[model samples]
Target: MSLVSYTKALNRALGDALAADEAVCVFGEDVGAGLAGMTLGLQSRFGAQRVVDTPLSEQAFTSVGIGAALAGRRPVIELQIPSLLYLVFEQLANQAHKFSLMTGGQARVSLTVVVPGSGSRAGWAGQHSDQPYSLFAHVGIKTVVPATPSDAYGLLTSAIADDDPVVLFAPAAALGVREDVTAPLGPVPLGSARIRRPGRDVTVVAVGHLVHDALWAAQELAGEVDVEVLDPRTLYPFDFPALARSLRRTGRLVVLDDANRSCGFAAEVLASAVEAVPLLAPPRRVTRPDGTVLPFALDLDRALQPGRDQLLDAIRSVMA
Candidate 1:
């Protein structure tokens, strides 16, 4: 039990998994050298064979992971940048994702791709600031966006242990979050939601780092409104039942997501809530603009992304 940073939690989780399972392996750019903070010192600890560094070809290396998975090895790929996900979409979506279903459950793609810094990272701008967790969720692949140091550790551990390919988006905005570890945190079940702030006025469903932002907004509006903040740790296989319970209690919903609005994950949550649960008013969502490519300018970047004020406005609108 100790204070742990979000990134450090990830490092510890990977380290623990590598230690526990002889079949678990890590392959990525600069992973051996620990260029990505999450893989820091892991290569030397696990050895070169298990934590192998690959070439610059995302497609090739991703296919290699699928091959390893087919051969009964658990592979974890670290894509230094979020946008690199687009490069291996074919390998991940078409091949590894379909193996088990195509073969009638004869194969298992026990693979996990960890994106250390997802979403807008200050000056990273367009190419580097992609938050594509929705893309994976849309394709039926397991996707997780952990917001807390503990969740980051627990979810990643679960993803690595799952018998499927999982993409983990470690939000850049959430990497700095530190939590007091009073006890040993265990693996959090996938498709579960965490009630960060319980309230009676409204249910604010926040994804990834926005969970923290939602908490902040809830505190700011403490006396005026009781805003409940819910974090859906795994975007796909969403825990709608827990959300329904919260919505039933609050009678209102607001989704705060980092992706673009059109066909975004938040839109799906809002639509599903109205269909499956009772709501007093139309659900609201605070998200990036449709067809948006974030600008590099500091002000522009902040303007394009969802923030606490947006969550506050959305919560107020839903209550109205």
Candidate 2:
């Protein structure tokens, strides 16, 4: 029974994966120095051979990981910033991601890319602060964003062990989040949605760090309007069954998402809900403005992000 932070849980997962399998290796910028903090002490324990630091080339290193995966090696790539995914989009989407189907299942890309400090961070500016998980999910890549430390450890372990390319987005806003733990945390299967807060009025589906905000908002709304918080941990292969069950219990739906409002993950979830589950009222989504690009100003950044008030209003709207 002990408390664990989200970052620590991620570090523990990487450590466990490296220790359990000889074929597992880590590659990324400044990984040897443990710059991202998720690989802290891993280089010393696993040595330079496995925890090797890569050059400042996201595309090259990602391609190398793809090649290694094809040759029967499991590689974990640590991208320090969420925006760096854009640099290797072709390598991931066209090459590694396509190998399995393009070759008719003879090859595999067993690589796990961990984006530490993802999503909007205070004053990280427009370039550094981007929550691009929706892009990967839209392109048919497996995407995971766990809200709790226990879930972080469990899902990361599962991602590293899976025989396909997976992207793990650890939101910067939730990095400091801690949880009191007692049981031995184990692998949480992908595509599973967790009901963080149960209610009868409206079902609220939240993503990444926004899940915490949804839970807090639900508590604040209390007797005025009961709100259920559903964390769709895996966005690509979303937990439709869980969403359907929640929708059945509560006739209203509200999605609280951190991404931009246009064609975003929130929109997709609401669209799916209305089509798959019968709702007494119209489903609503609270998200950033359309074509939103994070601003350099701190206050402007905060204004552009989704918060408790937005979730509360969306919940109330759905209920009304």
Scored by CA lDDT, what does every candidate get?
Answer: 0.92, 0.91
For residues 16-94, write the lDDT of model 1, one tens digit per residue.
9999999999988889988878889988898999998899888888888999999999999999899999999989999
Question: Which 10-residue span in candidate 2 carries the lowest summed lDDT?
Answer: 310-319
- Clashes by residue pair, model 1: none
Off by over 4 Å in 1: none
Candidate 2: segments with Cα more than 4 A from true spot: none
lDDT string, candidate 2, 1-320, tens digits: 89999999999999999999988999999999887789999999999999989899998889889988999999999999999999988888888899999989999999999998998888889899988888899999999999999999999999999999999999999999999999998899998888998889889899999998888888888979888889999998999999999999998999988998888999999899888888999988889898888988999999989877877777887777
Residue 283, candidate 2: alpha-carbon lDDT: 89
User: What TM-score fits each model?
Assistant: 0.99, 0.98
Worst 10 residues of 1 by lDDT: 311-320
